[model samples]
Target: MNRISGLPRMLAVAIIGALSITALAQSNPYDKFRNREYSNKGYLSEADELKLAEQVHQELLKQFRLVEDRSLNNYINSLGQRIARRSQRPNLPWRFYVVDDKSINAFATLGGRVYVHTGLLAATRSEAQLASVLGHEIGHIVGRHGLENVKRSQKYGTLAGIATVAGAILGGQTGAGIGELAGNMIAGGYLMKHSRDAEREADFLGLYNLRDAGYNTGGMVEMFEILQRVSQSSPNALGSILASHPPASERAANTRREISEHLRGSDQRGERDSSEFERVKPSAPASSKPPRKVRPRN
Candidate 1:
């Protein structure tokens, strides 16, 4: 009789142990990410993303001087709109900004907002190169890389929760919390460097956009060449330039290989440069001073 009773008790213990193990597994987010179980549909809703974007944008306005020239704004908008329209999230209200910062860097945020540093604009030799940069940034949005990063960080429940708690402590609107999350997320998480897989995906998407939009894909290669040269000396000084994008050499070689294998027999030579681009290039000053635009749209 004691043996049978002991058997029941042993079974209960086993079940409880199994339950505890299951709970532990479920709580660890990295396991899900490694197993490809993370949600791709996005962790946040469209409304929430838009709110976060607005909050971030407002913060940016106070931090960086924006280029408000009309011609330059229109030129960038025309280029950005064309590339963005070909993307998966074409319906999103895409807004591009020319940041007056002279750093050779550019980044995109939620809700289809992209910021191109004046230095980056000046660095490009042609419109096609500029498109390549814009295309890559757009790829991040359409590929939902920022969202993936946010979700990955959310795996750390404590840190993610702190964002919400901080917002509540501030006692502002719902958007305020999201804005805080965005600022922190970009500063330390999302908008920083991306995984190799994410970088490859964005590169391919960018090349596709550039090619399909009637631009020579060689421009992508040339742009990388310029970047590689820009950093060949004192690369450390320009670490921010490759903060999110991969090394220029690796990217250039990848583009060449992809073009040879997939885009074979296509026109390797399309419009390489444009007079209009030359007119607009100087608008991106090497200094932080706001460049003249025809009008301010963004």
Candidate 2:
């Protein structure tokens, strides 16, 4: 009777072990793509991606002169929050920072941090125009453009060196010499190219976010047109924005087509442009120097 009882207990333990293994397998998000072509390429565990983003965020804070104007910061945050609420990752801890530089630029990181140069804000004429730029950056984050590019690099086995540089950037122990190296690494190459599909998707999503946030979608077209004109006059002037993405004329055209065809005759009255926007514009810093070569890290 004792032996027979022990046999049933052993059987129960075996069944439990099997279920545990199955659960572990099912819980892995990347398992489904393990055998796929790009599965192994650029395969950063979600944990790594978040870690990289946090490290990059810290680096950004340390390297750039972050704006300290409370009202301006709050205003940008409010606009970002409204747009984020309409984004796919609404629950993310999104942050908006105003860079003190005068370059007309904006960028987004993987973990929902968006940086906008003061110059860009100064150049914009209205809240909707600003929203168009923010919407584009938001599009990059929502579309996971950086991750896709990293994956492509991984697929080609070219990401290992890049990942090493990224690791060094994140580790924060690199001395001044290596700091320059890492900065050069980030600003020198095409490590963060968003695919054409990703670009188009962001364009559409940006317009959607702008409209949802009660801004005029036409502002999207206008912003791109401004960028296009700037690019043609001196591509160097819009260095980071133009290089990381495609030509603004193409984007403007596409946006105009979408707005006309899809959102024809939409109401645009009563949209509130934050009063802070007006007050902050004149106070923003201007970049007197020419456009420097800065590689964009998505």
Candidate 3:
């Protein structure tokens, strides 16, 4: 009889242990690394991600000057913040910068840092288009692309080099040296392209993100169309985005399907453009500026 009683206690212990393990697995907010889940922070801790983002942000400022206009910054921030608020990592203190380059591209780094080119701003016909781009970038962060890159790159090795440099930066490395290294990795031509799976996930996340932020999902479709148009009309003007991801046509097709399947019946209304976007867009032109008028040519 005593032996039979012990067997029940043993069974109880085993069941409790299994349940505890399941609970722990479920409790972790981040997904398992290999699962390709959106909102994954990947292998990097949040602190490390922030440090890398700071370094990258510093490098971006050094390589491409940011627009000095406060109004322009505020306008981008307002929209970016709206999209980010609906993101999985809504509480991450996000930062948005307008790169002075008119190159028709935008990218997101670690933490919540995102950069938009002046060319892209000029190209977008509506605020919704801008939100689409920004939402895609936010998806990258919420998906943790930069950290994923570090994990996958044989050359980076958890970025041992960056760790050393980052330590030095915390101590004595000048901004220029760090900027050169990071700029080469980013702007100078060494960007790590995200996988097709990651790209598709970003598009999905971005699509929903805009809709949740009350922006029209159609904006994402239009943005993809703009990318396709740019790729066909001026391939060289395609910039880093196309170089890093799949073709715009594929992306556009996917967005159309998503709208059909998920968002077709929804009545979520979002702003297509704001007075601020209209007022500040002139300051962020694509390509080149028109020549100034000469008063005394006659």
Q: Is candidate 1 or candidate 3 better by TM-score?
A: 1
- Name the regions of candidate 2 deviating beyond 4 angstroms: 1-48, 161-185, 188-191, 267-272, 286-298
Model 1 over residues 3-83: C-alpha lDDT tens digits? 999999999999999999987565322122221322236456665566666666765665667787778888898899988
Report the number of clashing residue pairs per model: 6, 2, 1
lDDT of 2 by residue, 1-298 (tens): 9999999999999999999999756522222322222221344544555655665655565567777767778888988988988876677678888887766788776657788888788778778889878887787777677666655654676534555645554465444444354344345443345666677677777887788888877777778878887777866767465455767877886676666666775424425466767776666553543333333344
TM-score of each model, paired residue for residue: 0.76, 0.70, 0.75
Models, CA RMSD each = 14.5, 18.7, 14.0
List the pairs of residues colliding in candidate 2.
Answer: 42-154, 187-295
Error of 3 at 141 (Å): 0.2
With candidate 1 superimposed using the best TM-score fit, by how many Å does residue 49's alpha carbon deviate from the native? 1.9
lDDT of 3 at 210: 89
Candidate 1 has its poorest 10 consecutive residues by lDDT at: 29-38
Order of quality (TM-score)? 1, 3, 2
Q: Each candidate's lDDT (Cα)?
A: 0.72, 0.67, 0.73
- lDDT by residue (265-285, candidate 3, tens digit) is 432466777788788887777
